[model samples]
Target: MTPIGTQELDRELKKGSAELLILSLIEHRARHGYEISKLIEERSGGVLKFNVASFYPLLYRLEERGMIAGRWVEKAGQRRRRYYKLTAAGKEMLKTQRSTWRDFVHAIQVITEAENA
Candidate 1:
């Protein structure tokens, strides 16, 4: 699809920033990759979508860095799914990242729409 409206551009921006968003989501709860993708989309009002290939490597890297923990869970006669949860270190990091993200967005909002200039 061709790039279009402001909402579309907003989606593009969120897609580019999805790794941080996913980490933020899982910092609260352990989520499988697909579930993370869904929550990003849902929470963002359908503005964020993550491709599996891009999303998992970042998840693995965060795990490797001890920023997050991953586990595989299996149920009786069910599929095993990888779930990601925040480590204490990850929660600290996420607190900082979230503050940064909020500040960045607020700065943009202020510049773009502040008092209608």
Candidate 2:
């Protein structure tokens, strides 16, 4: 079984947060899957890695949901790569999701504090 702890749970939350983060990134500029993975790792001080095992399914599912679109593009980098860009729906959805998640986390923290008090 997977061990759960503060950091582990935070990491778990990140998986769910991945969609919003990816949308936020694509809002700035489109990127291939690997690029998205790399940015998350870099921006998070190497803490967040959307490595292939964790990243691709999420990407494919987002495409399946019509939230993002992917296409193959040839690059100077070793070989061709599949890039992802946010769709109109993805932009709106991300805004809604980000707000909800923030509120949820805030509420949880508040309630937990009250209980402790």
Judge candidate 2 against the unseen true structure and give its global Cα lDDT, from 0 to 1: 0.85
Alpha-carbon deviation at 31 in model 2, angstroms: 0.3
* Per-residue alpha-carbon lDDT of candidate 1 for residues 11-54, written as tens digits (9 for 90 to 100): 57765576578778886578888888888878878656666787
- Specify the poorest-scoring 10-residue window by lDDT in model 1: 11-20
lDDT tens digits, residues 4-116, model 2?
A: 99977887888878988888888767798878888888999977776688788998989999999888988676698888888999988888988998999999899989968
Task: Assess candidate 1 and give its lDDT.
Answer: 0.81
Poorly placed runs, candidate 1 (over 4 Å): 1-12, 115-117
Residue 46 CA displacement from its true place in model 2, Å? 2.1
Superposition error at 103 for model 1 (Å): 1.2
